[model samples]
Target: MKILKRPAGLILLLLAALSFQSQDGVAGSNLLFYGLAALALIIFFYIVVSVADNFMVIESKQIGVKDTGSMGLFPSFREIFRPKKPEYLEKAHVYTLTKGYDIPMAGEPREEIREPKVTRFALTPPDFFGLMPIPKMLVEEGDTVKAGDPIFFDKKLNRIKFATPVSGEVIAINRGLKRSIAEVVILADNEQQSRDYTLPAATASREELVEFLLESGAWPAIRQRPYNVVADPDVVPRDIFISTFDTSPLGPDLKLTVRGRMDVFQAGIDVVRRLTNGLVYLGLDGRGEDPSPFEAINGAEKRYFRGAHPAGNVGVQIHHIHPCGAGENTVWTLGVEEVLLIGELFKNGRYDTTRLVALTGSSFSDPCYVKTYAGANIAELLSGAGEDIAENARVISGDVLSGTQKSTDGFVGFFDNQITAIPEGNEAEMFGWLLPLKPRASISPTIPVLSDDIEITTNTHGEKRAFVVNNDYEQVMPMDIYLTQLMKSILVNDLESMEGLGIYELVPEDVALAEFACVSKQPLQQILRQGHDTMIEQG
Candidate 1:
């Protein structure tokens, strides 16, 4: 007893006594097993507490617009894990317009005179891959040019041409100060000249077809994710996603874009399907009873995401479904307007980037669709029409929520399909937050407001603020990954954490809506873009 009084010795003696008692079947191994079980129970309880504290809930809610019968903030975990068979039909009735509020532009008034000569140009150069200045000497400084004449060329002397959207004599060979390249100015010749071609149809292998498009000037319409740059035809993607609607403020309705173009749309899908071994997911934002235009495409899968802002974004939709993995490369996504160009490729075996874009806003004098093409200068497109709208409006190439502001010298963005003119409402409202809510205010509320019957304008009420709620990114975001953790890890440049978080599964465009409404106003798209580039560069 005196020797066993040492703590370690006493513990061993106790264990030995227990072992002997168990061998003798007095107290069987049950006592030993019970002790181990008790110890494990303590450890398990500690782990459970730790995990519960660490699990985060990031959510966002709708404040006041129109709230239909959505069940709750986000779908349940059980619903997400065991998805019901989606009876999703590509809505035959495509949305033609979005009714939301937008602040109007404010600027110095300009004259309503039209530029006399408007020279139209092809959007892409022949060797688009190589970097070189747009050619200068194709047309002499004072050469009189007609529609469909060579205006500029690349180093290979392949003519990058322009048609006088209006025929006129060359007024001046203006050069851009920053890039130092030729800018042809022509006075209007006459308003009578017009040329038109019948759209093409689908009929070749994906590579051969892409080459034809590149040569013909149509590749710019197909946008690739990770960088949101024009797709590189050389890199075959996992799949191609075509969005038929846009939820952003002032975005054009896809139903209008696809009018009388169903044949081409179907043909375009067929052509793109040849490029990827994966299924082509066509996204439409509609409910249980709309006539879907995409119903007839064989081998095509259709899905829908019904929500606000990024609900229509391809990257977000992909996030909700099949997220990109660490080593996975690229996926191609495009809007219905751009996909229409695809139909043109198969129909014509050439690139026809020319399409229609809408011009609208309270400041706009006349709101309507304008005939144009990708990469067409705004100066050429908005020449006479500028006077039709208010004097001090800000012109955005895309939409109020996510569009880029372009200068008069700015060419149309390759991905834009709508031009929005909103009055610049930079002036501070007196007691904006203190005032009782009105139907006029655009709020992202979870429940329908009392004045829900009012038609919402371009402006969705709600001052940009910090992200406080758990948005449940996986719910509205169709992809299968944790968005918040992924975003946090990417911003800190924690490469290891990012890898484990599935950084490769996204691009900036996917989080564009979140970036817009965020109070922090973090450059979320920039972060995601950098994360993608970092992975690409490392490879």
Candidate 2:
């Protein structure tokens, strides 16, 4: 027997011996004891074998996409439990957004203005922790742009444009104080926008393809973590990871989405392969019945994971399989559709612009799909979809648990194409927590009594606090990195300790759930981002 299996077998033998000794007194018969012992041993071995099979330590022997470094997501529980150095805190850059009424964290709730419907558009600058200096306007109020035209291009010619995601004339431009670009309003150009156009296929090198992607707005979908910067398509990543699973509420169905888009995804994989000499690994949901699209691709490797929310996360996946290191500088991750665009760009010369966004949530009148360009307006996308929504409701670009709260007037997130609309209901319960949770309520370990096996509705039936639980560590986290310790390190500005704790393996979204679940209302992402910035600055 192999070294590891031998111990397990020994354990079984010991268990059998114990069973034999225990049964020695039964019926004053050694024959009865032997039979019972045999049964007990069989049962014990069955359970042990099942557990080992489920928690198998899969090694990466070949150099396909699945060669995980020390930085990826699949370390064993023993390895994960090993002690590591601690991180310290540092001064952070904090940007506060408009907060009106405070849903009391502990005491009296603070009051603020209540609008019938809050519609505002706020854009985060493209660079990490960047402040937008009077954004240079590329389109005048009266100019007409084709579906795929540049509206704002940076000095490097990395353009940010609007394709009339819903073809429309520029009806209004809402500029804030000192002519800060607030929102660009368009009157839906029905005929022009309604026409569906597909890209014509063509082949190009990785560098040329990246430029084409930037020109077409597809590069925004490929987001890099650590710095939370969008990947510079011009540069090669050490490896590429494709995630076919999301555990967030109302998350996209990768299997359904990837269906029929395999060719485009293949093209995208081909392009990504060109950029990295390292392996490409595709992460599949362990719960999934079907093989992942990456398995269909020639060079990619596949890993299947089973567990709770963060288990399916790409950050966690990367950490388990292959960890990032100094020489293995950068690793890239993307969703299934984003990969299709890569293939679409090479197979067809044009950029695959419109993203397939799922419109789902309790606030939505109907759950559906919308074909919209990147950075399109949420108002336009939610126009007809909010038919059943309550008067006072919240609409977010991503899942309510982890997604940023965007104003109704805000544009869709550059990367998140999903639309999540949920009701901000008015019924105030006398004691909300005391009441029995409905089957629809979404709760994890902190809430307790939330049965693990039950399939509940995607909506968060619980109240939304700025933060309500101190779940910064193991509860919501499924990664190997010690989040609480890492956050402390970032706060105290401990770079070396942070590195030792695998800080480079994390991004804002990796900790977004912690923020959402925090009872203290701590800004988890901000802290993580700040820690990352401090590390970069120190370097």
Candidate 3:
């Protein structure tokens, strides 16, 4: 009876007893029957324990810990009997983008912008010119325009229009060579009146929906993969990918951003579902304690990804689930905030560009968030805020890795929700590279031991050199493509080789990690952008 307390011991005892009986010339039929019964009892006990474990009083937060503890044996059995969580079958092939000095801001408490008092907005043209050429200016200097009025229109794609965020008079139209518009500064009027449009969500055809999005400036939210350009109205995408969580250093918290706006987020999901005949895959943070707010969203397949940076990238998510092939109509990808913007447009019949923007960096006195429009002036937004940014500090419109560098007076990017301020590393160090005790961050372990609190700067620690093939770039690059080979193809203008190496599957941001990890300090993103532009031009 005591032996029965231990299942393994009881099984062994029964086997020994059965063998003894057989040797003593006991009935063979009775011996066989008892052996079968013992085996059945062992299996029955296992099933009961596994079922009971599911009902155990374990908190969701403690699940990972308890499952790895001494009591973890029961959970293992449960895993065997339970269905696996839905995820990409392909192993996530990527390296950590965070360098030794990239301190994580995830633990910092999120502060919301209480009352945003922005008086000026700038419509930057360069933000929209990724792969496509600059759009033709539609508004002149000192011209009055409504909130949803078009400021510029893409000449090649006439349907794509760039709208202003506020109703105001265009104070200045800054232009560069060839009369290309640089930034159109607008002075916001106290009386904000928006140009209203009719909501067609309930009864509009797919064609109607597409046309409305293109004209209303909501179509830019959806970006096609091959060249990472604006989604074409004529091509129906194979699928749509929405990333809810961003794992970039000092990235905006999506959960906090969409706290009370779940309804809008869900509405956005519905509209996106209608656009694509194929499946709409929504990616969320897999390591969270509670279920993601996006889990309640319907009409889309929810896939979870748990890892470091680029895990939150929609391109990474697409690669794991379904990759883009050459000559294929690319899949469209959108961020959670963009989806909410699209949803708000359909619901309100006017463009609502209000977003939660985070001001972060080691240079900030109190890093916090702000409630501002897409094209709000960065300087005006941080005017009264108690920041410790230096005069020469760099103000980036997005995360440090993939964001664009801008001046303090520059405008926030249309697609950016985070602004980082860091000191410019312009002072040269004597034998800095030779110092083995400096606390600066470097991806290479051969360098000096870096302090975790080290303030990262624009310094390329090392100078640009000849292209060297090393494991550094490949280690951080998670995509299945050959990164070094692809870079070489792009460098040599080998379009066919680049296509064969899965160039269509990449964007500038996708190769940003490789750029950071490269010892050569080469601008990988710029090279990829050139290749992307060339491919589009050749076509």
Cα lDDT computed for each candidate against the true fold: 0.55, 0.57, 0.75
RMSD of each: 13.0, 12.1, 10.3
Name the candidate, 1 or 3, with the larger lDDT value.
3
lDDT of 3: 0.75
Candidate 3 pairs with clashing backbones: 93-478, 94-478
Off-target runs (Cα >4 Å) in candidate 3 are: 1-109, 130-134, 447-452
lDDT by residue (97-151, candidate 2, tens digit) is: 1111111111111121111121222233332122243445666766665444445
* Candidate 1: residue 352 lDDT (0-100): 48
Report the lDDT tens digits of candidate 1 across residue range 1-539.
23242243455556556655665575667776765565456456545643443332211113321222123333334435642323543323222112222222222122222232234432333212232455545666567654434455444424322333234466566555555553455554445332333433335566666555555444555666655555666677887787777766555666666768888787787777787878788877663355456655565777665545566777666655455443255687767766666676566444445556666555666566666545556667776454354655677777655667776555566567777776655645566556634334223464335542332333433553454546534333435566677777876778888787766656665666555445455666777767766665666
Ranking by lDDT: 3, 2, 1
For model 3, residues 432-535, the per-residue Cα lDDT tens digits are 77764446655566764434456677777788999888787656666667888898899999989989998898988888777887888889899899898888
Compared with the true structure, model 1 gives a TM-score of: 0.62
Question: What TM-score does each of the candidates earn?
Answer: 0.62, 0.66, 0.79
